[model samples]
Target: MDVNGRVWLIEANPKPGRTLFIKTGERKVYRTSVRRPLQYAMF
Candidate 1:
């Protein structure tokens, strides 16, 4: 996100082809699902 300034991203699921967690946190909101690919991140 150069336009929006420096933004860092992380990979939620380190394992490939496998989902370890999904929809983490209720307030901040975090998602990681093997079923879904387009939307998922690891902190």
Candidate 2:
């Protein structure tokens, strides 16, 4: 998701029920979410 001037990639695993996150700036041109809550929303 794109927020402010940055983006975030969220990954979700169904089998293990876990989530992962990565900053879009750190990702490649097109390297790509889970249902986990986003903390940035508070900001």
Candidate 3:
């Protein structure tokens, strides 16, 4: 963030750590995150 309190996105990771949500006990989110891309590709 800057002096005016505006946030900036300086970088992004194309492949973020996948196990984070799992570690946080968000099993449903983890499953959906892994599933959606495969479903989209199959469609």
Candidate 4:
């Protein structure tokens, strides 16, 4: 559980979105990006 200097990116299931998880010592951070309706329109 010593997740220091570690960075990772992951995708959330059951929906269209992206997530990122980062950890450093006792601190942890997360970032998530959900595909916007307009953004998906191009696809």
Query: How many clashes (backbone N, Cα, C below 3 Å) per candidate?
Result: 2, 1, 0, 0
Tell me model 1's lDDT, rounded to 2 decimals. 0.42
CA RMSD per model (angstroms): 9.3, 12.5, 10.0, 16.4
Q: Each candidate's lDDT (Cα)?
A: 0.42, 0.40, 0.84, 0.38
TM-score of model 1 (CA atoms): 0.18
Better of 2 and 3 by TM-score: 3
Which of the predicted structures, 1 or 3, would earn the higher lDDT when compared with the native?
Answer: 3
lDDT string for model 4 (1-43, tens) is: 1379564646436432233233332223332223344465466
**Residue pairs in collision within model 1:** 11-42, 12-42
Tens digits of per-residue lDDT for model 2, 1-43: 4667776758644653232224334333223223224444545
**Cα lDDT of model 1 by residue, 3-34, tens digit:** 77876665555654333233233322223333
Task: Give the total clashing residue pairs for model 3.
Answer: 0
TM-score for each prediction?
0.18, 0.18, 0.61, 0.18
Better of 1 and 3 by TM-score: 3
After superposing candidate 2, which stretches have Cα over 4 Å from the reference?
Answer: 12-43
Residues 1-43, candidate 3: write the lDDT tens digits. Answer: 7899897978767577778889999999999988997898588
